[model samples]
Target: MAAFGQRKAQRLARADASRKGGLDERAAPVVQLLNGRARFCTTSSCSGRLVLAQGSAADANSWEVQKKNCTWLMVTHETCTKDDVMTALEKATGDVVLKFEPFVLHVLCQELQDAQLLAVRSTHCLEVPLSHKGKLMVSEEYIEFLIHVANRKMEENTRRIDRFYKCLEVALKTAISANNSPSQETENRSVYIHRRKRKTIQEQDVHTSLKDHNEELEPEDDTESNLAIFAEIMI
Candidate 1:
């Protein structure tokens, strides 16, 4: 446990080692929230992005475009326009691909249980081959369509990020509440029971008042003639 804490501290100290040299604005809050907890820390994350890159046609098996050999014509974290795509296409010399990368996050948890609390998943990014050997494979209209699709994907990515943040916030709060000391837990339980009893009493009072009101509305039969019949029956 001590070793893990030490390693986590060391890694977090240098967490901002990405090309941007900082955490992405959209992902910063979530990263901070996780890192604030004792059992979890974020290793890396990207809120989502659109990228136009030039890569070799022969490297079809590669999972990612090699940064060393590939050229990044354009990169944006926000939705882009068709003109942006065209401008980026002009710089492509090899196989070019336009990509809409969705929200991704990597978290390191101290225990498997801690990791299991996070169930959010991101959609796989979309990749469209735009150019082959400096020749545009698709028409301008098609590029516009691709841009529209990417923009829509970006909007969905933002929504997912928001949801993930909300769910994680709730899960972390529940975990923390569960870890409270015995005395605190008892106090909380007592408060809850007290509130519940108060509510029940209030409801009962309302019911009694309503019943009384209804009884008052009923016609009262105050006939002395019925008293004589009752006495005769008793006799």
Candidate 2:
């Protein structure tokens, strides 16, 4: 489809521009499987990774710009240790955060029906939390799935980092194992559109559908206070 092609092109270009090797190695197999399908294409992805960062502040406001303004104590594609986090915290002057992100991805589905189907299955089956951020731009004409591990945080940077590291390990295993089946892959590729093939989707209907997807992927909002006094470990 033209819409799918254009979005895919933009994603590929963005990946090509990345200095961190673009796509993460661990995410390649699942990305290939989804992209190879006619009904789905990945828009963006990160195969679970960790970050040790220092920022000016540690509040919800700071989190919005954390990535842009933060100082990287260390970043790893693999797991790290408490000592690793501690060492980094020693150099931490401002709010220090050790973020462990699970394998997360944004997928574009060809149809609203298909999006619903994928979303349902992804949550009930794949087990990773999926957020539907509808119609970001003209390019996000298709439905989008923002999949990620449960983001964990603590005010005690060191303690929270320890918990996050363990959480990341568990989430990574969940993501990898969830994709390890031939039957599961087959099901993911299956098309779900039916009955409304002729029904015209109106502009107003688009907003409604987006709302449904948001409800379908309900996630808790956790925006708390600043974090300080930390050590970071990098592996």
Candidate 3:
């Protein structure tokens, strides 16, 4: 844990040095809260944003260089103009996707259990929804969560982005709210523990039933992958 803190501080220093611009006004508070905690530390994060990305053809480069490949025609932490969206579209050579991302914080927790506790506490206590994306690249490091205020979706994509942009204030308010009460945190922790135990029991039951039936798990098929590829091509 001490080692983790050292590395995290080092990274934060590097990040601070690398930043040429100021922090997003809306995301600053959330970032401060996560960084101030002993049990939690923020990794890479962006306050929710709207980005105009060119299609895959424009990304002839490697997937690892996707960030470089995609032209961020517009990057905003708050509501944006429809005129700006139109301007980006005019500049796009390939398909353009307007991605509306909510303020997302990739938080590192001291322990796996601690990750769960933080997730529930932040959501239930602080009204921030979080997604548990499993472990990090470093084996010695701790668990991480993709904590954000919104869900990623392609449904009515542009319309959704516009709508989210319009309601950006509400989202920002929730993200920056000082709603973390001690009682709420305790209740959230208890609920998270209960859910974890229940999940473990369910997994055990499934394992026992599979053993009793002597049923072997089937190998994964490539049908879904092929279908996804076909869909991508069609798109």
Candidate 4:
């Protein structure tokens, strides 16, 4: 624990090394929220991005644009326009790809339980190999179609990120509340025991209590519907 604390402090104190050289604006709030808790700290993140890159043809997969050999023609954290992608395509020299990368985050958890609590999966994004060896693989209409789909995915990604932030905030608060009250913890344990013994009768009461708790924690914006889709990778 001492070693972990020392390492975390050092990591937090160091300068950001990402390409943009700082925490992404959209993800900063959640990163700060996690770091504020003793049990977790964010190491890296991307709120999501739209990217158009040119890469070497010799790369194992024609569509796989490795950062080492690829040149980024366009990169934006926000939704992009068809003109933006078209302009970027004009600059492509090799294998060119259009991609909508979804929200990604890496966090260091102090314990196994902390990591498990945050385990979830996000929705998939779009990636199309728009050009192969300087030749367009698809029509201009298809490129526009890809852009529209990518933009929609970007919007969905933002909502997923927002949901993740809210869920984590509520979960952390609940954890802290549970830890601070020994009597409440004991009562919860007793409820668990009672439910196991008197399944039918105790289960209904437990369900009612959990429903009430969830209602209390739910945000005014009604983001609870897709709370299960938020993603986090724990290290």
- For model 1, residues 1-235, the per-residue Cα lDDT tens digits are 8877898999888847676677788998888899998888789988899999898877645535677878789999999999999988998778898998898889888988798898666555798888887889999999999999999999988888888889889988988878777877887677666665665687578769979878543442557535643453344
Sequence-dependent TM-score of model 3? 0.45
Between candidates 1 and 2, the one scoring higher on lDDT is 1
Model 2 bad stretches (over 4 Å):
13-15, 58-65, 120-235
lDDT by residue for model 2 (1-235), tens:
7887787666655645443757776666666766766666777766655565566653524333246786776676665555554465556565544465555667887777446544421221122111112111212111112112212211232343344446544654565577697777766444212212212244347658878878443442333211111111110
The Cα local distance difference test for each model comes to 0.82, 0.49, 0.50, 0.82
For model 4, state the Cα shift of residue 154 in Å. Answer: 0.7
Q: Which of the predicted structures, 1 or 3, would earn the higher lDDT when compared with the native?
A: 1
Residue 59, candidate 4: how far off, in angstroms? 5.3
The TM-score leader among the candidates is 4
Better of 1 and 2 by TM-score: 1
Give me the overall lDDT of model 1.
0.82
lDDT of 3 by residue, 1-235 (tens): 8987987787677645313255665556666765776656777655456565554453433222156554555565555555555555556554444556554556787777546544421221112111111111222111112112112222233343344344543543453343456776787667666665665687679878998999986654579645744454344
TM-score of 2: 0.46
